[model samples]
Target: MIDPKLASAAETFTLQCVINKRPVSVDVPPAKRLLCILREDLHLTGTKRSCDIGRCGACMVLVDGKPVNSCLTMAYQCQGKNITTIEGLAADGALNRVQKCFLEEGGYQCGYCTPGMIVTVTALLNKNPEPSMAEIEEALSGNLCRCTGYGGIIRSVLKAAEQGGRRHAGRHESA
Candidate 1:
């Protein structure tokens, strides 16, 4: 069953933002988590929900070129912001370089954390292009993945960085 508060919240607020370079408008409650808004309201479920808090990073999204835990962010906070999710990473059905690297490196096992990991790594490579091991670790510190043991995950990111990914620094790139 849907919560009455969520319904009421949806009725009380309206948000306007660009998601994956496309403008989106939603009516939502002020307190609605960005995760819910993305998955439930906007149907962008590529950004998963795990732990329901900021620690998991499962709901990571790019808000104006920075990675943010969407589970902890208010839906209304995204008004007029540029938001990017894992779904937005690809263009014309081609995998982004990070996604491709992750696939080749076997960065994911169960794949539950793949989206968040990709989101973080995408943001990291965008900012650092050629991040050191420590920077990669720091960029991914917020996300938790029990499947890949983080070995293949880090390697995939490093490989992406070595492959012209640095050119995307501080910007969002579509695969």
Candidate 2:
């Protein structure tokens, strides 16, 4: 038998984090997943929730400028951190080069995995402005796409890099 007190009430904490480019503070249980925080509380649905145990990269996001599986990351772990979702990749009502390239290259079909794929690629391009095909493959190893095949996605990444990786190559942002 488990202790009733231990399970009766969940402990909560004040989470302070920078989401996208804005400051946000919220109260949540420490064990709660960041995926839920983004999709539910914060209402940033661009980050998808799938395979809650972290098997899928659908809930991937950038934490401190590196890709992280939000599903596996707890709320407390995000405290005082900078998080970037798919929505953050764009600015001023304009699509970022990576995003535009994806569209131009038809990088998605079904589209369930596009957000996570883009987030992961965004981090990679930001870190390495001109990544080779092998490098892109290695960086995206953790991200799985079931539709649209990988041809278009690869082309999109290549095209984004060729386009100067504007959003990615111009500047670097860290948590």
Per-residue lDDT of 13 in model 2: 86
Score every model by TM-score.
0.89, 0.89
How much lDDT does each candidate structure score? Answer: 0.86, 0.87
**Against the true structure, whose lDDT is highest?**
2
Which pairs clash (backbone N, Cα, C closer than 3 Å) in model 2?
none
lDDT of 1 by residue, 73-170 (tens): 99778889998889888865678889999999999999988899898888887777879889889888999998778999988988999886656666
Write model 2 residue lDDT over 1-175, tens digit each, in one string.
Answer: 9688986687758899999899999988887899999999999998998888877798999999899999999998999999889888777656777788899999999999998999888888888988988999999888889987799999999998887655546577321
List where candidate 1 sits over 4 angstroms from the true fold: 1-11, 165-174
Worst 10 residues of 1 by lDDT: 166-175
